[model samples]
Every structure is written in structure tokens, then in C-alpha cells.
Target: MWSVVLLWLSCVPAGLQAAAVYRRDVPHQKVEVYSVTLDCTVTSRFAHTVMTSKALNKANSSQEIFFDVDLPKTAFITNFSMEIDGQLYVGNVKEKEKAKKQYDKAVSSGQTAGLVKASGRKMEKFSVSVNIAALSSVVFTLTYEELLQRKLGHYEILTRVKPQQLVQEFKIVVNIFEPQGLAFVEAEASFLTNDLLLLVDKTVTDKKAHISFTPTLEQQRTCPGCEGSIIDGDFIIKYDVKREKSLGEIQISNGYFVHFFAPPDLPRVPVNVVFVIDRSGSMSGIKMQQTKEALKAIFDDLHEEDHFALIIFDNKIIKWRKYLSKATQQNITAAQSFVKRIKDNGSTDVNSALQEAVKMLKNGHRKNTIPERSTDMIILLTDGNPNSGESSIPVIQKNIQAAIAGNMSLFCLGFGNDVDYSFLDVMARENLGLARRIFEGSDAGLQVQQLQSPLLLPGNLA
Candidate 1:
């Protein structure tokens, strides 16, 4: 009988231990309570979550419990601590933004959205601790937000995620939607792919999305026999996409389009050109007259931002203006008048002319020293060879090189065959510029055309 009593006493302790554990039952989920009652919304644009309840129940009643709540995936609760009836529960609460199925449909249909959209999740939870209690309730809240889609015209998209609790594994899914009858132009998920230009036919679809098309070289329809005829044409184009992803179906009816045109965008660089003209005896008649006309045309082509200085070289380099000035009507007229007054001189000292031009450019560089507007250029025109004062090719080349290194572009114009083409070529090549050989007759205008062509081309040399 005594042995039986001892066994009963041992069983009593086990029963008491089980009875000591307590759990509190909450009717509503903690997230629901916080969102509805406390009016707390997740503020993160991405996925985020927070727990709203931190209570314990030590009652001795056994009961069923239910958790309910409407939680967004963008909640911003940084940390969460919870205990049920003095016992911490090992669990987690989370929220996530759902991806749209329409996006995937759009990609398949060839109506891809230019912007990239991503998805994210945030969650917080705790383990239940052992303590005195009855029935207990554990409440959690989850929220998440989808990543933004890539912007229109952007070639690539990237997304990232961080979970509140460390997880063993995870999976992500992206769907892309395409317009009906839309063809895949090109796509790249990894950064290691070459970007390809895509062209869409205007007749293929009536969608209003941006399109890219290779510019077609239209036929030179203008009469080739006509003098001074400028030929030009454009190529038809449609929308273009460089990268690819399976984010979701994109809708074509939504007007997500791509467009392109010929010759791409061209960047214009401001120019500060000094016109150094030779008015020596050789440039007296037709040469001088043609030079005046060419100068006028050049002045007309000057952009409002371009700066110019006119210098006439004969017995000496005479600056019509002491400094560079805007190509305004007043300044252009003044320059033209000065050119008209110039008379045929006795000698052609090209070296002195060049030195004076360099001096002007150097002074200008030191004055209005803006960062990108520092480009300087010299357009040197001559009919006769260098006649005096350091006239050797080597000496001239050395001076030209120094000016170029100081950010000056040199263009040499050889009027008539009497002018040395060899020297002109060397000067131009050294500065990555151009050299034009003008014939004696009416075709001299061709030299001006040649000079203007290089100026229009896109490059730092211009």
C-alpha cells in the first residue's frame, strides 16, 4: 500500500507541471487589430511587416482560437517581440506584394512595359516560451510590396529582397505580357549580352508605343548634275527593346510602345573659330573675291553660341577685332568691311600670321575659362607659300602641334595649286582636322563645302 501511494505522488507532480502551462486566446489576429483599431499602415514602398500584439494569458480555460486580418506587403515594423501566457511562441508573421498576371500576358503578346516591376516580402515572428497558462493565442502580421518596373527607354532592370527571418530556401516568379502579333525584337537578363537595335514596321500594328527603326538611305533622287544640290532622306522605324524578363504579361492596348529614327542623335559642340585669311599679292583678283563669299557663307552658318575673330595676313597679321566676339550682324558687317579694305601686300609671312592667331587663342583660353566651352580652332587660308620669317615646314609644324596640344583645332585651306598641299595635309592630320585644296576656277566653292562637312560631323575634333 505504501509503494502504491509513492507512485501516485510521482504522478501528481507530472499533472501539476502540465496544469502550470498557461495560454491566452485572442479573438482577432494581432495584425487585424493593429491595422483596423490602431490605424497603422505599412509605409515602406517595398515589402515590410510588424507584429502588433504583446500580451500573455494565465487563465486555466481550454478554447479554440482564430486569427484574421487584412495586411499589406509594405508594412514597416522594424522589430517584433511576443509572448503567449508568459511563453514565447516560435513563429513568424509576414507580408508580400502580389505580382500581376497581366504583365506576363503582355510580354508574351509583344506588348512589354518599358518599366520593370519587382516583388518583396517582410515578416516578423517569435517562439512560444513555456510558462503558467491555459489556452493561448499567437498573433502575427505580414506585409509586402512589389518592386517597381523598369522605366521607359531603360535597357536593364534589377531587384533585391531581405526577409525578417532567415529562411532555408525561397522562390521568385516574374511574368511578362506582350501585345498581340508583337514580335520579340531583342532581350537580355544578364549584363553580358550585346544590345541589338530593333525595327518595327509601321504597317504591322497601330499601337502607340515608342518604336525604333533603322534609318533607310533614301535614293539620291535629286539631279546629280545640278550644282550645289544638297541630298537628304530618312529611314522608317518602330519601337525597340534591348533586355528581356519574365516579370508578367504586358498589355499592348495599354500603349507601351518604342520608336526609333535614322542617323541617331547628334551632339553639337560650341566652336570658337578664328578666320586667318591671307590678303597677299597672290590673293588679289578672283581668289580674294571667292574668299569673301566663302567667309560670308561661313559666318551665316555660325550658331548663336559660336565665337569668331577675323585676322587678315599680308605684310603682317592684322586683327579686325582685338578680341573674339559673337557672330552678330554688327560684328559680321564690321568684319566684312575690314576684309573689303584689305589691299594686296608684298609678302606672305604665314608664320607671323599663325603666331598671332595662337596668341589670341591663348589669351582667350585664359580669360573666359569655362569647363566644356574651352575648344579653340583656327581656319588658316593662304594662296602663296610662306615667304619669310621662320617659314620652314618643321618650324611651322612645331608651332601647330603646340597650339593643338593647348586645345586648338587647325584647318588649312590651300587656294589654287600654287599653295602647298603637303604642308596643309600635315597640319590638318596632326590636329585631327581637315585640309582642303581649292582649285583656281569656279569650283573653289567645293573647298568650302569640304570644310563645312567635317564641322557638321559629330566629334570632339569639330
Candidate 2:
């Protein structure tokens, strides 16, 4: 897990919620933020960074100050520390049981302590509070590392800023070094304005780039009245590198060498896709409509080089065609009509449905009807647990594994909160694929479009 675990004399008010930055300054909040800086260094595929925050308590009595930052869930926190009037305290790792006991003791006795938790899909929330002595200052420093993953085309690194009060010095610096060569660099921020664009400096060369965002106190204000800080969004940096066809870019340093190869402009690998959908009675009303809409859009995105099959299951499995059909216009139209006529009824038979889909793909590959160069994939979408035919998760997983034997990738989409997502996730991972949660909403269909993921275009590094 890419999580940051911190233990110290950290505490928060009983009812305070987790937040990256305060949206607005509270009247009794006497902590004054003087300076803040976040620096990121990226070398090829890995990134390491630190965040430093300095604040002073101005009230006559001690007050609580929080250090909150949001980071990608795929990042690792290496170190965390706090300095109070020159006395420093650092976090040390401990066994889970021991740590839990210590945390409970601190909280029960009304001593300072805090907890870390997830915030969103891509980001984890790291928050801690410490009581600052009156008229004294505190410094909080955090360091972390992550392996950058390229999506679509570029790699992105970002920081969330929610400093409720304007600081005299607020700066962010990102330095990236690519072994091949710098293709292009772009800087953006949710809170960036026309006038603030000048502060977003970008300097690029052959293999290195330095991007900075240094906004002044006046620029960070929400308005002339200064009711809240305007620096309340993400500061994101995106960039890519030049690539060679075969030899790629190999860099030797210290004693070891690394080779990075991402072949550019390669034709999309032809795929025989089996979309296994659930029409169990639970999938009625808007859920059914959204699934239909999503499927139609997906069919439209199919390429001539691809072949697809549609299978809908309730208690019994139904197929639109007896075999995998080319993504020609006629076949797509027929599939769409079959989907529009689908009605929700009967109990879920997830295990049998999956096994049947896998059987179809395996049979096609064996019959030589599907091209030898084409890949077979099962995109299974369901909103409920198995209720018929091998309902046991372990049995279903073992049976499917034996049937496919790693011959095809199985991607699972668990729709709505009612799904046992972990069950689906394990099945996908066991079969050379991944699982995704399709959130229940109007945009549910759009989420299905994410099927065109990094799995399609893989970059090799050694």
C-alpha cells in the first residue's frame, strides 16, 4: 500500500474533519503560517519529494496546528518530523499491534495523537495536529517517494494546497530528468489565473526541466477583502520524453545501467473482447438505461481491427452471436438491438456467466476463427454477488483459473456499492487483469470508457 504512517505527539479537536488546507480562517485560529515550500525531484521513472511548513502560534495560550497534505495513493512516505522551538521529534516504525496500543493510550488519556486515512480515489490524506506553545514556532517536514506511472501519454505529479491563510512565502518546485530527452513540459493549477501565469515558470532543455510556482501573499488572497486564501487547489506538472524505436534510452550511472523502452506510434493490438454483462433483476430502472448507454458508446469506439462478442446473463446466459464477430457495422447494429431488448429478471449466476464467457474466447482462439495475433479479453460487469451455480468465491476463482489457464485477461467492473469489489478484484488479478469500481451515477457509462487503460500499451523498463 502507498500509505504514509506517522506517530508522534499529534492530536486534533474531537470533531474536526480531515482537510488538506483550511477553506477559511477561523476567528479563534491563532496559528500564523509564515512560510511553506514543496519540492519534487523526478529521475526517469521515480520521484522523491519533501514538504516544509513553518507556522507560529500568536495567542497567549497554546493552540493546535495541523499539517495536512494529500498525495497519490501509490506513493510511499519515508520520513516525517516536527520541530518545536528547536526540539525535534521524529516518527519511528513499530509493529501494528504496538502502534495501535500506543495510539489508543494517547487518545484515552487526552494526550496528543492523530490518525491517517484515505481521502479519495487517487489520493491519501495525511493529517496530524500538534499543540504549539504560545508565541513559539513549529516546523513540519514530510518526505515521500513514488514510481511514476504514465497514462495516456504523459506522467503527472501534483500537490494539493489549501492553506487557509496567506503565507509570506509559498513556493513549489518540480525538477524532472529524463534519460532519453525532454519532449515537452506543461504546467497547470486549478487556482492559476491570467495574472498568476507569469509565476508559473518553465525551463526545459534536452534532458532536464525546472518548473516552479511562486505566488506572493497578495496573489494568494481570494479577493481584496482577503476572506480566504485563493491557493486552494492542485498544482500539477505533466511531461514526457523522447523515445528511440528499438535501442531506446539506456543510462549507466554509479555501477548499474537502466534501459527504458516505450515504442511510439505502434498500432493498437487487435483484441477479441467479450463483454459479459449482468441483467439480474437488481439492474432495473436507471441502472439498466445507463448500462445500455455505456455499451452503445463502447461499441462505437471499437476499431475495424477488433472483434467483439456480447453476452448477457441473469440466471441463464444469453449470447448475441454463436461466435466472436468482427467489429463491422452490421454486427454492431445487431448487438445494439439485442442489448436494447434486454430486460432485468432472475437471480445472479456470476460463476457460470464468467466460465461461459471464458469458454467462448478459448474456443474461438482454438478454432482459428479469431486471428492468432489478436488478444482475448473478458470485460465482466456485474452489480451483485453470485447466487447460483458455484457461488463460493474460492471455487469460482479456482474453476475459472483452470478453464482460462492465463490464456485470456479478465477485467471486472463492480457496479454500485452493493458489489463485493474485493471478490472481483482478486479474480481479475489472478487472471492477468485488474478490477474497477463503476460508481453509481449519471456518468456511470463514461466510467466504462476507462477500459482503454495502460494495459493496452505497456512500456518495458529494466
Candidate 3:
């Protein structure tokens, strides 16, 4: 199943006869967005919703109208639809290849329809564009689904708000119904201001919540005369549910059952981690320097109860030590120094690098130096696809999975624009871990440090 959610649906569809009602707010703008609404309903923490945005081309001639929205990266859009005036166009979603083919065929006549591209650190951009005759309106709707996972004892719902222009009527509403009873619920936005704060609302009962953020046209302006939108960041809702002490919570409904489990805090099990660093030529200047800084910060945060190893590689592998070293002050400093010495040279050998990292952990565990209860993982950082030494993606995935043998997790970080993010994403998924693309920027070090939020992967499941 794919992850999907409807973002806005506050405006009713009954009376949309006038293009004047759809105002973009910016005078002389070719298109007028009359209404924008996101309505999300969650039952037992499973959300079902859609976002609806309406725009009318008020120009004297045909003009290109675009509907753009940022979506959570984890959500998979299973179905998408667009209404151009009175014509309803429905599209099916399945395997990526098939779905893409359908999309290509729909707009084969050369008119634009939809485009989904990777956007931010945790969100993707879903865009739709159509050429509408003067006075015609367009309605865009997207459907996607994702199973929300608990992180740091709470579930978060994130929606990216980027309507491109100031909308006359804009609102987002989320309704949550939890049968087991809600522990707490809170909502906030990155663009919230004094006046916008008043528009944000949260009503939570033991078993339900109604959260909404509806800023008026005046409240969305940057200044008295500015027509630009102030709503261009993340809208987040965080909440959790009460859990029982047993095997978590299980509910039976309509002859089906769902088991939800996340036990309370348990004693920390020491982690055995191996840092697989890539120093290919592409990671020459800023990337290398930022990576070293990130590694130093990472060492500063390691728990003393944990053990770690370092493996830096391009075409060749270099080990920091013979085996895992305890995260003591002295060892962390030495590891930091080792990271600082990594320079850019040679071609990438991801396959060989990962194999050595896995072997080091497996060997340590076999030698009994690594505690049996400790969680083991490999964090592979690369800035480009392998251009040397077994560059085959499928072969690399197969070899790495076989070497790890489900005994540990593998999290991959792909850096820069040229990196093969999809390969890393698929590999990480197959290995019970996940992958994230680290955009190349001055804040790349902070991006690396932010990888700390990977939950349950290295935790002891109760």
C-alpha cells in the first residue's frame, strides 16, 4: 500500500460559478485562486484526507495555471486527480513505471499535467499545470497514504504549505479519532505569527482532536501592501496514544485487526556502529570539510556505553582500529582526528567499503568483544554513485544484504545532486534501515547531525 493524504478541502463545491470569487489577491495577476482547503481525518491514527485548491484564469486569453504543493517524503501517492473546469480527469497509481507511463500518455498532446520531484530534506514537490481558457477554473486533488510511525514517543503529521501565491480563502483542518484515548495533541506552523497564531486551533479530548489553522487574507501578508504569501513552511501536528503494558495495543474491527506497539522507555542497549565514509574525488572541497565537522560533532554525542568503529574509503578501505572501540573521551577524540585526515581522491568503491564495514562488526561480535545485546548498524555516506569497483546497483544491494544477513541495519546518506538517491533508498529499505539525501549546502554539517532522529532502527524493540 502507498502512503497518501488529502491536504485541503474546507471550501464547499456547491457554488463556484464566478471567477471573481477565486482571487489570487495580487492585483493584475493572471490567475485567481478563489479557494484553498486541506481536510484530513484520522481514525485510530490512520488518516484519510485530500487537499483541494481552486484557481481561475482571469486573463483575457488562455494562460498556464499551476497547482504546487510540498508533500511528506514518506507518503506514497496512490491516486491523483485534476478537474479542468467541468471535465473530470482520473488517474491510477500503481507501480512507479506503469503510473508514469499513464501520466505521460495523458499529457501526450503537449499540455502539462503533473510533476512529482524531490524537494526538501523530508518533503517532495507535487505539481500540476494546465492551460485554461480565460474565466475557467482548475481544481487539483491528491491522495496518498503513509503509516505514521512513533518517534520519541509521539506521532507527527507534516504538511508542506506552498501554494505559490496568496490565496483568498485558505484553511487546513485535521480531525483525529483515537479509540484507545489520546495522550496529548499539539499543532504548530513554521510561519506562525501573532495574528496567525490566533487562527491556529487545537481541541483535544481523551479520544479525539480537532486541529485547524485558518489564517485570513490579511493575516497572510508580509506587510500592509505586500501581496506575497507568508505561508511557505511546514504545518505539523504531533500526538500520541496511551499504550498498554502487554504486547502493545491490538484492536479488532470488521473482521480485521491492527497491532500497535511501542513500549515505554527501556534501559539503553549499547550500540555498535561503524561509520563508512566515502572520500571520492567528487567530495573534494566543501563536502569533505563539512563531513569532517559533522563527524566530530557525531563523536561528541555518542553514548559512553556504546562502541564505534571508523572505515574511510574511496577505492581502498582504511580502518581506524582493529575492532570496535568504546566511546570514551580519549577514543572519540582519536576517531575525530581520523575523520579529519580523510581527503578527496580515488574513485568510489561502495560495494567493497560496505563489505569491510560489515565484516568489522560481524568479526567483533563473533570475537565476543561486542555485547550480544548491543544494536549494530552501518552508516554509509557517499556523494556520488560508484564509478569504479563493482558499480552495479543490484549486485551491490544483493552483496551488502547477504553480508549483513539481517544481523544489523544499514542507513545510507547520499550527498550532493549527482548521487544516486534512489539506489541508496532502495538498499536501505531492503536492509531494515532507511536512506536520506543530504543536499549540498553550507549547512550540510547540520544536515548530517540531524540524522539522529532515526527511531526504532537501533533501539531494542520491547
Candidate 4:
């Protein structure tokens, strides 16, 4: 018998340290940020997600502040602006080198050099120093796109909230319009939801959806005597269009649109995939057993047109085939036998394993031009830190980046808390991919299947 344990980890830092900047004109007493006002507008037409955060300063002086905004990895921002005292300063996208120069100039000139950077784990941190003019507030707004995703026959959007301190006021309003008739709408939150209001148009003719969720910490019994309510976690919304068919649905109203693409009828683009498995000593027990079961099950789902390869690594690299092979029944049976024979023993040689996977994909691409139109992916599963050949993360990431060379996507699965998930996340981000952490106690095989099922394409709006 095998027992699995599920570990819930904090995805965000405990708190942000926004130290006060001292100056002659600055107030001697520390300024407290009393309230944070958040307004978000998500649309499906262009699939844009725009958000504005206003921070009010209580003390009568300038204050320095920093906050991290966590968004989906698919999001890309094109506009960033700050509004202060009825004046707006907008920032334009510039080359990395030019942007650095401009930022430096603003700082040296005693101007507000607000910085926005993509931190690890799908979060962006914004830092700015401004004079609030004694009890005033500064508003920062960023506009981005690619917040809509499709899963399990529905469209989904996620909004994260993790303010270390409770603000006086925090409100979030979302307006959605679907032409296919507002079929179904639902919201899920880890915090209290009694304060949230969902107003839907009963008349099918309206074809619109609106959701407003506000958290009230004062009424919470979990943390009593705390001025603000404990609000920390994600606010997720999932909705489905009423239409029965898999054909996508779109809705337009007042020059704005939201689309739900669920094309189950369309033939999936053929895929050439490589499953890179780790057989290090740490994975010797239930981990290895679950992995083998997962691989065998996945092989059964491969279409005839799709091709696959299997490579398991420890101290040395092992390949199931010299080149990619068809997903024929006989071949799949042979692969299952190969997977069953893989016993964990040696140390982890991630560097070599990744290189070999990329090499195989590149060679396969060169030999078969048809797969160029298809998607090439490497699903790497690792459970231990690299201890053999080229162990440094930077070196391994660089080599893998060079080998893939923007041609293929890499999906990483870190098994359990023992693996370095940060490394996987960064590498996947750089390679136009994503990494998922698989908990041990749960259905490990099911998680693997979920990650690979229906394979999301690059820039896929679903």
C-alpha cells in the first residue's frame, strides 16, 4: 500500500518591506498606507485585463511603496501609467537597454522612477516613491491581455489578492459579455464570499454577465480585533456558454467583446512529444511507481499521427529510441516494457538529460518537415536536485535554452517539495512554457495527465 501526502505552500511572500525614503522635505514620522483601492476590468473581445491600484498615505508627507501583482503567466502588459494629483505619466515600452537608461535618468533627476519587473512565479513587482502631499494617494494602472483560458468546457479567469495588511477599502468589479447568451457563471474564493454580489441579467436578450466581489474583514471570526479582514488567496471565476456544440462563442456589446473558444470538434494539431523522466535514488519508491503508471496510461492516449519518445535519466542518460517513433500499438507495448524496467539508482544528471531531449527534437524536426507545423514539447519530470554533470541551474538553463532555440516548448513537473520548483518555473518561463508542482499524496498520475491533456498552444486564447 502507498500513502500520498498533500502539502499546501504559500505562493507569495509573507510581507513586503517598503522602507521610507528620507529627505529634508519628507515627514519625520513614518507614513502608513491606510487603504488600497483595486479596480479591475476584464474583457473577452480583445481579451484584455486592465487593473488600477490606488494607495492612500495617511501621514502628511511623501512615501515609498512596493507591491507585487500576481497574474497568469500568459499575461503581457503594454501600458503602465501613474496618476498623481490630477497629472498622468505614462510609460512606453522600450528596448531593455534603453529602458534602463531612461529609468536611471528619472532616478538621478529626482523624479519618480517607478520600476515594474516580472519576478519569479508569475508575479510582477511595482515600486515607486512619490510625495502624497499629506493625506493624498497615488494611483497606478497597468493594462494587459491574455487573461482568458479554457478548461473543462468552460472559460476561466483568475484574480489574486494578497495584501499583507487589511486596507480600509478593497473592491473588485468584473463585467463580462458573451453573445452565446450568459450560460452559466460561478465564482470561487478561499476567503469569505458573503460580501460578494453576482448580478446576472435574467433576460436572455441582454447577453451580459457581471460579477462584483468585495471582502469584508471586520466581520470575520477567524481573526478578531483586527481592523481589516484577512483577505489572502485567489478569486477565480469560471463560466460556460449555453450553446451545446463545441463551436466557439463570442459576444459583442458597446464596441467591446468577450470570446469563449471551445473547439472540441476541430482536429487537434499533431504533436511530437518527449517524456523525460528522472530515475534518481530519491525517486526509488512510490514516486517511481506512480510515474511508470502515468507514462503507461499516457501512451494509450497518443493518436496514430502523433509521435513520442521516452528518456529516463539518473547519473547517465537512457533513450527508448534513437529517433522519435510512431505511437503504434506494438511500439507502445514495447515502451511500457521499457518503462517497467527503469529502476532508480544513480544521481540526477538533469543537464545531460535535457540536452539529449532537445537534441532529439531538433533532429526529428530536421528529418520531418511535417512536424514543423505541429507542436514539439518536452515534458520533464524531476524529483531531486541535480548532483551529476553540469549541476548549476544557470549553466543548465543556458544550455537548454540554446539547444531548444525558440523552436520547442518545455513543460516541467517538479515532484514533491524536494525538487527546486523555482528553477523549473524560470526555465519554463524563458522557453515559452510553464511548470507545475505535483503533490505527492494526491493522484500523481492524474496530475500528469491533466498537464498534457489537450495541450495548450502558444497564445491559445482558450
| Per-candidate alpha-carbon RMSD to the true structure | 32.0, 8.1, 8.6, 12.3
Candidate 2's TM-score reads 0.62
Better of 1 and 3 by TM-score: 3
Residues 1-462 of candidate 1 have per-residue lDDT tens digits of: 000000001111111121111233433222111111111121111222232432223256433322222222222223333333443333222211111243233234422111111121221111222222344443332223332222244212122221211112212222222232233223222211122122221232322222222212221112334322111111111122322233323333246422222133345667778889998887777667768767766776776667789889876778887788876787778877887777777778887887788788777777773224545788888874887677788788887787568467788877753568798888877885667655443334433653674553223211
Ranking by TM-score: 3, 2, 4, 1
Index of the highest-TM-score prediction: 3
lDDT of each residue in 1-462, candidate 3, tens digit only: 121222212222433221221223334478888788998888876776688888898888877666677776556676677687777766543323344554454444343435556555566766655567788888887777665656787888988887656888999999998888898998888988877888888899889999998877877888887988898888999999887666666778899677666556756677889999999898887668667766765676688888899998888888889799999999998888777778899999999999999989989888998888888989888874887899999999999999988988998877754568899998998897878666443345555555664522245352
Q: Mind giving the per-residue lDDT tens digits that candidate 4 earns over 297-383?
A: 577777777788999999998899889987788888999999899898989999899889888988898888336677888888887
Candidate 2, 264-295: lDDT as tens digits: 66666787889998998877765677678778
RMSD of 4: 12.3
Measured with C-alpha atoms, the lDDT of residue 86 in candidate 1 is 43
Could you tell me the lDDT of residue 393 within candidate 1?
83
Off by over 4 Å in 1: 1-263, 369-374, 456-462
- In model 4, which runs have C-alpha deviations exceeding 4 angstroms? 1-152, 155-238, 241-267, 369-372, 454-461
Q: Which candidate wins on lDDT?
A: 2
